[model samples]
Target: MNRQESEAHVLREATADDVHLMLSWRNQETNRHVSKTSHEITAEEHARWWSAVRDDPSRRVLMYVREDLPCGVVTFFDLRLESPRSGAWGFYLDAEGLDGRGETLPAWLGVMREAVEYAFDGLHLDRLDGEVLGHNTVVRQMNRRFRFVEGTPRQELSDGREITVIPISLARTDRRQR
Candidate 1:
């Protein structure tokens, strides 16, 4: 992938038009496998979830764009926009779409970089946090590359099964030191 093209990415506020696409991505088998909620979400469920959080001040749902092509979704929740601003973030990419175009790796890396920038710079957040399944070592390594420190692992019941969750966090100061 061209360096310029890989870096040509942006994050934009998700709109009503993106609801379907977001739902499709979220429901992808690969995505659902590692998610906190592993079931295929019904249209009604997705609608309710979107409606509840779309305009909520404490949550942000953004569309990830690479070279003008919408390729993923980024979300920030549990946002505390006060003096010690902090939030938890999560994302998922259009794996099938990007893979067809041979842009999967670049898009994946770009989304993370842009999301981190958005969390700290665009949102003026003091800290950022995320949760990754223990078995998802690839993503955990990626998070560490971005200076996110991993916390203790905890077990949570999801879709009738217990899953190990590893909490990771990055502070504004730590990011700046990169």
Candidate 2:
């Protein structure tokens, strides 16, 4: 993959049309715990969320575009100025992987890389928090690759799934050495 093709795996800032797609992915069984909703959300509720994000400075809802197609999604949101330089983040890729043609489906590591960069550089955050199902060893390992440490174990109310909330941080003094 060249620069553009590779970078096509990520995009920041989601539009209105992207919200519907996001909700479907969130309601998927694989993404239930990692999502904000236990059930599917209506357009009205989604609009409220979109409006709040736009009105809030410490929030960003982004779409993960791969090969110029919307496949998965990632977000650097819930920014707290009281504890500036910190935010909550999450991502989801379709389990299906990709479609025919050059467009890839589901989610990929390239988007995760860009999402982390957005958390550190784009959002200028010192710490970003994420949660993974205890069963999701692959994602847990992936978090470690980004220096995310298992912070605290918490129960996911959505599906009664046990999860470990990890912190993938990048402080001012500590940039990149990995």
Best by TM-score: 1
Q: Give TM-scores for every candidate, taking all chains together and pairing residue i with residue i.
A: 0.94, 0.75
User: Compared with the true structure, what per-residue lDDT tens digits does model 1 show for residues 6-120?
Assistant: 4678889999999999999899888898799999999999999999998899999999998888999999999999989999999998887898999988888888888998998
Q: State how far residue 9 of model 2 sits from its true place (Å).
A: 2.5
- lDDT against the true structure, per candidate, is 0.90, 0.66
Per-residue lDDT over 46-161 for candidate 2, one digit per residue giving the tens place of the 0 to 100 score: 67877787667867778877667777778666786565668887777654434334333235566777787777777777777766666567777777766676765555544353
Backbone collisions counted per model: 0, 3
Model 1 lDDT on a 0 to 1 scale: 0.90
Model 1 lDDT at residue 8: 70
Q: What residue runs in model 1 are displaced by over 4 Å at the alpha carbon?
A: 1-7, 176-178
